[model samples]
Target: MDNIFKSAMRGALFFAAACLLLWGIVPEWKSVCAGLLLGAFASFMNALLLRRRVEIVGQAMANRGMRKMGLGLGSRIAMVLCVAMVAYKYPETFNLPATLAASMVMPFILLVSAFLHHKRH
Candidate 1:
């Protein structure tokens, strides 16, 4: 699982870097690229947060330390909401549709990473 997450994160980071490069080279599509960059960044942070929470849950379960612990969905939602708000606030600088679409990309990244990892191993 950790290896899969790391692979997905590397893919996401590469994507974000590409977006940044596009933003620099293409002035006309700056808004769209900026949106993609922000969304990808947010998605990365959310994944990291989720990974940490899952690790914590696993540790707790192993130790029988807690009865119930949420996976921090509320915080993740808040982070996404914040990204949406930022895109909304800067309509000229960020495309909302692109931002929203990009934000949902991490799960797919994770899926593909896992698939490739499984195939390789």
Candidate 2:
């Protein structure tokens, strides 16, 4: 799991940097690139939040502690909502559709990493 997370994080960061480069190189596509950058950042954060929550839950379960646990779905949703709101608020600065699409990139990266890890092991 940690390996998956680390690889995903690296991929996400690389993606975000690429988007930033594109934004600088193409002034006409600034909105799209900015939106993608924002979404990629949010996606990375969402993955980190989920990973931390999972670790906490695993620790609690191992210790036999009876505490309610959740995967922080609400927080992740809220984070996405905030991104959407930002895009909506500044349509010229960010493309809404691109932002939404980029927001899902991290999960795909993580999935690919998991598949590769499974095949290797």
Best by lDDT: 1
Q: Candidate 1, clashing residue pairs?
A: none
TM of each candidate vs. truth: 0.93, 0.92
Q: Indicate the residue-level lDDT of 39 in model 2.
A: 90
Count residue pairs with overlapping backbones in model 1.
Answer: 0
Cα-based lDDT at residue 108, candidate 1: 94
Which residues of candidate 2, in runs, are more than 4 Å off? 69-71
Question: How does candidate 1 score on lDDT?
Answer: 0.90
Per-residue lDDT of candidate 2, residues 26-111 (tens digit): 99999999999989988988988888888888888999998666649999999999999999999999999999999889999999
Residue-level lDDT of model 1, residues 46-93, one tens digit each, is 898888888888888999897466749998988889999999999998
Clashes of 2: 0
